[model samples]
Target: MAAPEPATATATSSPRPSMRWRVVDIVIASVLGVAGGLVFVLWNLAYNPVTAPLEAFLPGLQALFHGVWLFPGVLVALIVRKPGAALYGEIVAASASVLISGTEWGPLTLLSGLVQGLGAELVLAILLYKAWGLVPAIVAGAGAGVGMVVLDLIVWYPGAAVEFAMIYAVSGILSGAVFAGLGSWLIMRGLARTGALSRFAAGRELGSRAES
Candidate 1:
């Protein structure tokens, strides 16, 4: 009688890492994008009116609201943990906002979305898509904020005073870091706890915690 060879550790381990999006991944990512789009629309509607007082208080302070538009990238990237996830999520979300609710910014909004998504995407790429945590979230949010401000300066705020640009940039960074960064992390944690993300790493981590 012959005996079978023992399985190597490598052979028995999980599959190699992949950037390819599975059907489930696309579905979940699209759902997140659509939800983000709806929020973007509402935020656009309320932005001017809600920030009127702030705009009056400080010309550039209203830029604080910029973070709301940046969240989709961070949230999707963290959840999907895949290449292009941030860009795909943000662009789709932006397109949805425009198609569903319309925006005064017109098609330019799409460009903004592209750039912001790229910002977060760049961060994820830099991290090699190996980490999804508070620090990465904050960095991604801040990166999105930087992309936003650059475009704003060129497209909408050219010739603006240095003080105004600085204020706008700083406000945006802070807002993105707190509202988008921390906010998305909290939301992901909640979703993971609910097991809705069971197939994802974030969900699996929480699932393990429950068992322990």
Candidate 2:
């Protein structure tokens, strides 16, 4: 099959919207970033308590929950459809989380967020920000997952067993694809339906679908 892309058709005769950031874009993007950070803060608080048993049961099962940290970048990119949206959202969210809840990694959490955001951002760039459908979301999430696991392995699982590495990697990808990718897509759909996203193309895409 061909590489995945969204079918966000625009009129050939119409001018394409500028990719430059708008004030509204920044505001909405910040809202998403803060929201994502709140989720991250909650996950951070619960992580050890939740993952201790899982790690004991299976060394890498905790990676399954890693997706909880991945969606903000993607959700921002989809909604904003602009360059750096994913990275900006991810960093803002990480900053908020650190300021509020502080992680074991301290300020290094920002670096992790940057990597994850780049993971999603790179995919969007590859597609030239033209695709925002399910496949693109999943692919972007998968990209973020890869970034997450690479950093994780380097920092947390260094000198770990091959089996652990393999499991962690696969689980991370799956988690991102589901929680970050599919999760964000579903959230966008709901937001569109509620008209909260009416100012965005994502929302317009939903409207076009319903009308058809």
Q: Tell me, by TM-score, which candidate is best.
A: 1
Native-to-model Cα distance after best TM-score fit, residue 117 in candidate 1, in Å: 0.2
Taking all chains together, each candidate's TM-score versus the true structure is: 0.92, 0.91
- Which residue segments of model 1 deviate by more than 4 Å? 1-7, 11-15
Expressed as tens digits, the lDDT of each residue in 32-110 for candidate 1 is 9999999987887788898899989999999888899999888988888899998988998999998897666768989
Give all candidate RMSDs, comma-separated.
2.0, 7.3
Residue runs of model 2 more than 4 Å from their true location after superposition: 1-12
Report the poorest 10 consecutive residues by lDDT, candidate 2. 4-13
Model 2, 1-212: lDDT tens digits are 98755554554356776799999899999999999999998888799999899889988988898998999999999999999999998999998898888666756799999999999999999999999999999999999999999999998789989999999999898999999999999998999999898899999989999999
Q: Which pairs of residues collide in candidate 1?
A: none
lDDT of 2 at 53: 94
Q: Candidate 1 — what's its lDDT? A: 0.88
User: Alpha-carbon error at 95 in model 2, in Å?
Assistant: 0.4
